[model samples]
Target: MPEGLTDDGLAAMLVRGLRPTRVTLVEHDPRWADRFGARAAELRRVLGERARLVEHVGSTSVPGLAAKPIVDIVVGIDDPDDEQAYLPDLEAIGYDLRVRESQHRCLRAGDPDEPVNLHCYPPEHAETRKYLVFRDRLRSSPEDRERYESVKRDLAQREWRDVNFYAEAKGPVIREILARGGWTD
Candidate 1:
């Protein structure tokens, strides 16, 4: 676990159930970029200067990779744990708080056909940059991208007790890609 975040703290982050469910990965959608762009614009309009950085990360951000069809965005804020600063600001624009971790928060919104997840983190958070780097690496390196896609495609076929478990299953592959991608400037 991350510093200051205990095991209990991690478990408490879930705002809802972790029932068994399967995620279906779909073909790369060209419109995901536009969807992310629109959301980023809306977030900027609402948060203004407080929105330090808004980026499109996750499988959807990669051009040819298959994904869950949800747009995952990372917003760098002054402080993620300070809900008063951005939680309501984002909620005002229709985002619902889903996860509140030690140094991060996740908000979800959008129609059922295409949901959006906003990950909020401090401007200096390593996870925020980690997301961007992983995304960029996949975008540029077809070899790693294909390898990730294969793993995701295989994992997507299994019925997961929790979506987090599915994510955990991808750890080895993600780490391999991240190793090739590097972690620092």
Candidate 2:
């Protein structure tokens, strides 16, 4: 993890267990989509192919749904621990390394003054692909999107000490849907 706290921890703490306001189920907004593209463009200009498959994923990536308004971007590379190879470049491009999840082989970046969550994951990791699959599935299927949105709403209204615990609470439903969608792997 980063010398201080990993980005995941920071995010959890930042929210102070604030559950997302609501789940959204809509088409992506061209404006936000363009912002993601611009951000990816900046990353590309700086890191070249180091950020192999930079993608906009998360609630903001989905259209028409009310969200927390934070853009979640995934930047994939061969290995995240090999920071020496990409850190300096990313730093130069205006992304500050906020959290490091060494155990998870992931890192998060963002602008200190501005605000965005950029999750870094190794392309070889299952978590990386799983996130993509889940996001894609939610975006394409209204039934699944509504299902997830409903879950978010139900959970958000409840109080929880740890935000992670709240997120973990959704595991069963996520697994159930993923499994039903033929994503048993």
Worst 10 residues of 1 by lDDT: 1-10
| Candidate with the greatest lDDT versus the true structure | 1
TM-score of 2: 0.74
Candidate 1 regions exceeding 4 Å error are 1-10
Show model 2 residue runs off by greater than 4 Å: 1-30, 103-114, 159-162
- As a TM-score, model 1 comes out at 0.92
Cα lDDT of model 1 by residue, 94-129, tens digit: 899888777888889999998999999887788887
Question: What is the C-alpha local distance difference test score of candidate 2?
Answer: 0.65
The residue pairs found clashing in candidate 1 are none
User: Tens digits of per-residue lDDT for model 2 on 1-185?
Assistant: 12233436656435232343343233445576777788888888887878788888777787754454557788887778788888777777666665455523333445532246777788666666767777777778788878877787787777664444555777877777677666766
Best by TM-score: 1
